[model samples]
Target: AGEAIITPADKKHPPTIPVTGAAVTIGVELGCAATPQSLQINGNLSNAVEGSVTPSIQGTGTVSGNGSGGSTGGQGGGSGSLSITPGLSATAADTVTTGGSLTGDIGPGTTRDFPIATKPLSGRDGYVVARETRVSVDGCLGGAQIRSYATAVISTPLGENSITTYGRTLFIDRDHPGAPPKLKPAK
Candidate 1:
């Protein structure tokens, strides 16, 4: 929500406030359990101003499924966790956290939903806005060769429409049982 007020209630002339378009930043990180249990990471965005920004995910490891985004009003806070349905024989340990709702369907080597806002932000000047992206090991299971990570895109019609980021890498060796799974950040 955005509200405006006269700064200096008693002042004769109110100074003109400088409004800057919001700047969007995307970040990716890996989250791992103690053992070779699961792989996960956090994806976050910092908006320099106030507005509605759409976030989407695309990856090689996961197949794209159909899903709708959440409601479109007010400010959505915090990065929530999403459990992806496994497409392969592997157990369901994979998950992804995108500030926006998951769009694509959930399955091994398949990324989640893509959110496109019908309404653009008002392009008002405000405080710094923070959003999160989380990627878990559950997404890297199943299939002949599991894709390690996915690519993230944050877009806003206000200024820069699209900014791209990537996920970390997971090393899974079926032959070497003793060699536990390893998680590495995107290079």
Candidate 2:
């Protein structure tokens, strides 16, 4: 992990800030089904700012949660998008017997918007994946649910100038690829 010396939006009175909000993910249940189902969602959110790093780092972040059309089964399918206001919060949630559930948050951090590092801040793209299962009363229904978020930032080392930059997230997956997980750990 790399340490990010965040330049405050205000240059006159700079404050100590770090690059937070790496991403948060939660596994969801897709419910039980007579047949297995595969789904995928894709989206991109980006924002760039240009200003002095004195009183405040001048810039705004604009992200649109518009995912690619989702796949559907013979019975049903799903689709959605998010238009978030700058410095505002947005949320959505729901539940069904067959499809699992998901609750997620994608926006700027409490202290600041994701640092728009001038260069690829080690694009290590650090991320965390979580999984969970919730069974129905009959024990024959319920599926694993998962939700993940990734965050990154970059900037010049202290005693230097800054530049303009931006970033976004890419959600991807292979439907039923059929690649089994390795049972044994690498020696």
Candidate 3:
């Protein structure tokens, strides 16, 4: 997992104005038997100014998972990554970028979520708006399913800004028998 920042328009500003960094933390809990877990996180921030416009881009990614198994128990693992980019086209405006990701696996099932935010960082400043999220899942008893949600708002100092939000959910279950053991299928 890692993060990065790109500056394509800020050659006039000092290099110190643009910086990037990332960090990650992981935790795991097991009831019994052997369990393995791992995690990674990363991100970046950058900005550039050219003429009367400033452009900035930032991104982040994370991956984590756990697995456990006994004589009959099954093992599971999961991971995911996300990123965002924001830019200001004119000198009289600001831009923001944000994103998140998650993934997990349990037994014969898997789940994932991805969220993104794009808007002005400040509300009292100028017109700002944008939001988005998505989710997906798969199960041994079900096949595969996906859902999406989004929101956006535009505001100005003179009046109030418009607001919009939406959400969705999905589910699936299917039976899938993996390859038999090296010997033969369990009776």
Candidate 4:
């Protein structure tokens, strides 16, 4: 991550205040020791930000979900685009169920969008976007990591601006001692 300042090259530069802008660049490398054939990702959306995870598989696989669509509320609204890939299968739904296994098929090399918004009924503290996602990639021997991008818009009296952030999450099967107890341990 890094940042730089840009100064105007106009005559007013003598007394001009340099505008300072920041840029953040993030990168990650996930090492999977074994070959994976299938992949699954259970995701969540919270408080004014939207994101998605894409799993690329070399062979056939199934994904379960409510499909894709858009919704609007008194506060805000969001929409999703459909995946257009040959041999791809999917289910359609107006609302995406939380904490449930999604049922659908995302074509290889394509991605899906999961829109998120803070519920209107949320009380003060606004909303803490804390949720656990379980990811399963068949044939993975070591571990798996997923990365995605999230963006939010900040509105103020001055103006409104959008900012983007990178997110990374790791997946460990219950077979490993580090896995949460709720997850079924390997037999």
- lDDT per model, in order? 0.35, 0.33, 0.39, 0.40
Best by TM-score: 4
User: Model 3 segments beyond 4 Å from truth?
Assistant: 1-106, 125-141, 150-166, 171-187
| Top-lDDT structure, candidate number | 4
Query: What is the per-residue lDDT of model 1 for residues 1-187, given as tens digits with 9 covering 90 to 100?
Result: 1122213345787535432333333233433222323435545654443334444454344234444456664443344445544342222333444463323333334333422222222353222222343434443433222222222222334433333334334444445434545746648
Ranking by TM-score: 4, 1, 3, 2
**Candidate 2 global TM-score:** 0.16
* Model 3 score (lDDT): 0.39
Which scores greater on TM-score, model 2 or model 4?
4
Better of 3 and 4 by lDDT: 4
TM-score of each: 0.20, 0.16, 0.19, 0.23
| Total backbone collisions for each predicted model | 20, 21, 8, 7
Question: How well is each residue in 1-187 modelled by candidate 3, as lDDT tens digits?
Answer: 1112233356786444322221111111112111223333455455543447668888888888889889999799988888787766665444455555543333433444444433332322232223232333322333554444333333234433333333333333335534433534448
lDDT of 4 by residue, 56-144 (tens): 43444455444444575234444554454444344433544455354444332312233332222122112224235333344445554
Which stretches in model 2 have alpha-carbon errors above 4 Å?
Answer: 1-5, 16-141, 151-187
Ranking by lDDT: 4, 3, 1, 2
The 10 consecutive residues of candidate 1 with the worst lDDT sum are: 143-152
